[model samples]
Target: MVQEIDKLTDNVNDIKSLFRTLNETLESIEKRLSRLEKMDSIEHRVEVNQIDLSDIKESLQRIEETHSNEIQHINRRLDSHLVKIAKIEEEMIIIKSR
Candidate 1:
């Protein structure tokens, strides 16, 4: 009877050790899952920021294009006005001589 009791006690101790190992493994898995969740959140925020930056770049490019076009138009108008003034001055000189 004593031998049987010793065997039972050994089996109980083995079961307890197995339980402890399983609990440790579960805790490790939980920590890893938490870390993954945090990484995912950070990645999502980075993606959103990237999209916002891209939109800002596109808006700046459009503004630059508009300003360039406006400058070219203004330069053309100035050139046209200068040419008209020169022609008017020549006409005045001829009239004054007569």
Candidate 2:
């Protein structure tokens, strides 16, 4: 009977050790799951930022095109004014010669 009691005690100790190992494994798995959730959140934010950057780029392109068109219009006006000034100078020269 004493030997049987020693065998039961040994079995209890083995079961306790197994339980400790199982608990440790579960804790490790939970930590991994938490890290994955955080990573997914960061990835979602990155995607949103990329979309915002794309919109900003399009707006800048539109502004650049508008500025280019305005510059072209100003150049045309300047050319017209230069032509008129030359014609006036030519007329003055002709009158002075007379």
The candidate that achieves the highest TM-score relative to the unseen native structure? 2
User: What is the alpha-carbon RMSD of candidate 2 to the true structure?
Assistant: 3.1
Could you tell me the lDDT of residue 68 within candidate 1? 95
- lDDT per residue (tens digit) for residues 1-82 in model 1: 9999999999999999999999999999999999999999999999999999999999999999999999999999999999
lDDT for position 71 in model 2? 96
- After superposition, which runs of candidate 2 have C-alpha atoms over 4 Å from their true positions? 1-22
State each candidate's clash count. 0, 0
**How much is the lDDT of residue 75 in candidate 1?**
97
**Pick by lDDT: which candidate is best?**
1
lDDT string for model 2 (1-98, tens) is 99999999999999999999999999999999999999999999999999999999999999999999999999999999999999999999999999
| Whole-structure CA lDDT of model 1 | 0.99
Candidate 2 backbone collisions, by pair? none
> Model 2: how far is 86 from its true place, Å?
1.5
